[model samples]
Target: VWSREEEVRHGTYRPQSSAQLKATLGKDGKISAWRTDYVQSGDAEGETSFIYAIPATSRRHFSYQSNQRDGPWRSVNSTQIGFYNESFIDELAQAAGEDPYQFRRKHLAADSRHLKVLDTVAKRAGWGTPLPEGVGRGIAIVESFGTIVAEVIEATVREDGSPQVLKAWAVVDCGTTVNPLNAEAQIAGGMVMGLSSAIGEAITIDKGAVVQSNFNDYNILKLAGAPAVIDVHFIESGAKMGGIGEPGVPPASPALANALFAATGKRIRTLPLMTQAKA
Candidate 1:
């Protein structure tokens, strides 16, 4: 944590700032220590748009094993933060010269319960199997509000540079679920919402006005563009009850991004994976 005096001395505390973070992982593939610092380049002005912390996404649970913020509970918050954190997890896996799935497994020693969902989802998705060129598979596990969800996404980057989600599998552990059908529906809806945000949804500002006002202009996922199959599997972990609605939203983006990376060897660092061209 940088104090205001140290921030001013280092010219880092200001309205507009950019930050860089570093992570040190132990031999066991868990983070040992993490540090980030902000570098501000603008005047100390009216409203600040710069802040940073350990991401409060579901991935936070993983880092607790390594010894690692709370904020408003929102689906989009988890979606966006999970997107970022899980993408980095894949990168770290790659950097360690390990398969992403295996890398995640190595770091799951702290919680076999989490691994339960991961193993189920991976088996359903056929992890470690090879796919045809232009097709890729990615995996993500998220625990939110005591409900854990592990999802696998299979995506194909078409010749025309479009990305298509072929299938999705979600293994959920929302303990003592009362209504299985409604939980399935909520998880499915959350997955669709997360995928839409990851694939095509965006908001723009033009001339001090909002650009996208409705569904037509907003460009959400259409029925024809939806995944061919989305399988939701529930695991009654016999723990206390948990909600199902929001946990499903967070992993969709990262799983899709990881799938794209696997398929094309092109890592995605931003949202809306289709908008960017392969390098």
Candidate 2:
């Protein structure tokens, strides 16, 4: 399961009247710049977590969305911002003796929303097409925050013994998309962010403090290690407004892990696949 708090800012600009503008301008006929800063801050505080049963047959995805101030926010937003707990993937895969990607796809296919995302990503990623000798592809999807997200990752091992994320194809359905450009950016950004976690990032705890204090230890994927391409597609069902905040996280880790399994015979059970690949 996952939990988060988000604060968003919106600003509006209004031009002052001619008299006010003239009063502010200097006698030299050049207007001096006067600036006033205003802040409108809103806080969204809530907890969302999920649990899955063994055999991976039973899955529960739930979340709650409430503002610091009083008033009902739409259920659509609430559903889109809930928790996604993936702890059951490993246990279920073990129980079925099946690949995690296959298991997840099988389960997700039962839901219409998830199925649409899977279909779109598969088509975009060329799921069944052949690849070079060392290349492999893996795919996974999750339903969170009223959105269904699916991702396909291609990975390979380089000569220096490092795993590389070559490309990522992502599909998301957040009901009716408000802005296509922003939506595309959101998905692409999420994939890159997830790539960081998959390849070379971690936060460790020791004794009672965070042991990895700086970027030296808390690494992120750089331009050299970043995926060459991330393709994002959105499904417009004309249903309702869904989520855009965090639906991008769940798919990348597992997809990258599966891709690593293809590049190497090893199945990655933990995150930061680069660490294990190097070892």
Each model's C-alpha lDDT? 0.70, 0.58
Query: Cα deviation in Å at residue 75, candidate 2?
Result: 18
Model 1, 184: alpha-carbon shift in Å? 0.9
Q: Pick the candidate with the highest TM-score.
A: 1
Task: In model 2, state the lDDT of residue 35.
Answer: 24
> Candidate 2 overall Cα lDDT vs. reference?
0.58
Query: Mind giving the per-residue lDDT tens digits that candidate 1 earns over 1-279?
Result: 975434323321112223344566667655555543433332211111111122231112111111001223235245544565577778877877888877777667545677788888999888988888778999987776667788999988766777788999999988888999999999998998888878887555466444655676667899877899999999888988877878888889899999888888888876666655353
Per-candidate RMSD, Å:
11.2, 20.1
lDDT (Cα, tens digit) per residue for candidate 2, span 193-240:
777766776544366444554465667778888788889988988666
Candidate 2 Cα errors over 4 Å, as ranges: 1-111, 205-213
TM of each candidate vs. truth: 0.77, 0.64
Q: Model 1 segments beyond 4 Å from truth? A: 1-21, 27-30, 35-76, 277-279
